[model samples]
Target: MYSPTPSDWREANRKRWDERVPLHLASDYYDLEAFRSGKDPLRDFELAEVGDVTGRSLLHLQCHIGLDTLSWCRHGASRVVGLDFSEPAVDAARDLAAELGLTADQASFVAADVYDAADAVPDTSYDIVYTGVGALCWLPDIQRWAETVAALVAPGGFLYLAEFHPLADILDDETGSRIEYDYFARDAWIEETPGGYADTTTPTVHNRKVEWQHPVGEVITALASAGLRVDFLHEHDTTLFERFGSLELRDGAYQFPVDRPRIPLMYSLKASRAVA
Candidate 1:
């Protein structure tokens, strides 16, 4: 039986993310140089799903290092704010924004827990609330998360969530075909992962951490209960990372082998708040 206090788990994860900031900044996977040279950090799925943030005020929650948040500004968002629990990540984002010459009015970064975002951020509502890949699994409570998301959305605005499918998490990535873990949300997963997806070779001090899994149904239901109407849910066979051994890189994304069974690796949902 593995059970840890929420504060303990959050601290462990924050330390891990803090260590990852430097590695991710230098890793080819993130391509900091490309981002510095004016390349978009956002993926194609989000670009199509979120559909143009030009002059919109966007909020990115659980934003690690704020690559996607900065990208929103590059796409012409008038206001972009990123919130992450990791201090190092937030600092790096702020430095990068300054280096890129983004004014304070254009972008800002805050160090705060997702659950405490209402206190950390000034605006109670935003035109768009965007949360990207690998963000949800870190949150233990999806219902509370959805409530925060709903509170952040301006009237008539929408929340866009692009996350790795829970099904993908159950698959045995080492074997790449069978399910090894529980598909449904259960107890917290406590483990010692010294390496991260970005750079596995680099050793990390904050190795022990906790993660939670939320099924697709749970995610949708949480949002709906939070007063947001689900507009659309789209699942994709391709993913941003080669999460399984059987997956192959195709056009910058990972796809299952031609002969293998196709499964949903990622999903994006758009939920809207009605005007007051």
Candidate 2:
């Protein structure tokens, strides 16, 4: 298939995210002050699935604003480094780390594309390589992304990813019931919506952004192909965002109405590089 993403995706997507930095920082959605007061942006399942991080070095790929990265530090990760393509995002992350009284050795942020993570991070490898939610869609090639991330994983260490289920891409956005798009379609998805998800009413420029869907199977295959041992792939019925109009927010999670048949709205996976 002909690809238009290679020539233009980075600049467009980075511009979109960079512009949203201030919006996200000020918006009630992120609530920076509350975060400073000790808010956990991470999902409960994520905390349990990844297990203890005490004294372990962690590299958070595509860590926007460092809320989750800093959270790992609170969870006892000895060192945490966050990387993002947008300089604005990385700056915000660095500020957050400092505000939390964390030094560079404890928590650091780098401005770099996720594809260059192996070469750009502070260390050659980490005990844990983490990818947070809603980040995978921004990348065009799951395979290349897998290889890049896999190389950053230290021997006996693992990579944990929590992402929106790609199956949701095929469903209608309003109801999330009717099949509306092809799941296997290989093409760049361009969106020109003028606002960020954090504050939809807040108007913004640099609206053009590109995204792509990678099926759960494709992601697993990519990681395994990159020499990681797949430990577990867990699908969750709840999500943090109101992805569908019909979703109901209950106990910090959004779920389909009780009458509606439940489907996986998010998924998490653990893939580990074998200890030599």
Query: Could you tally the backbone clashes for each prediction?
Result: 0, 0
Which portions of model 1 miss their true places by more than 4 Å? Answer: 1-7
Instruction: Score candidate 2 by TM-score against the native.
Output: 0.98
Clashes in model 2: which pairs? none
Among these predictions, the greatest lDDT belongs to 2
The weakest ten consecutive residues by lDDT in model 2 span 1-10
For candidate 2, write residues 36-94 as lDDT tens digits.
89888888999999999999999999998889999999999999999999999999999
My TM-score estimates for the predictions, one after another, are 0.97, 0.98
Prediction 1 global C-alpha lDDT: 0.90
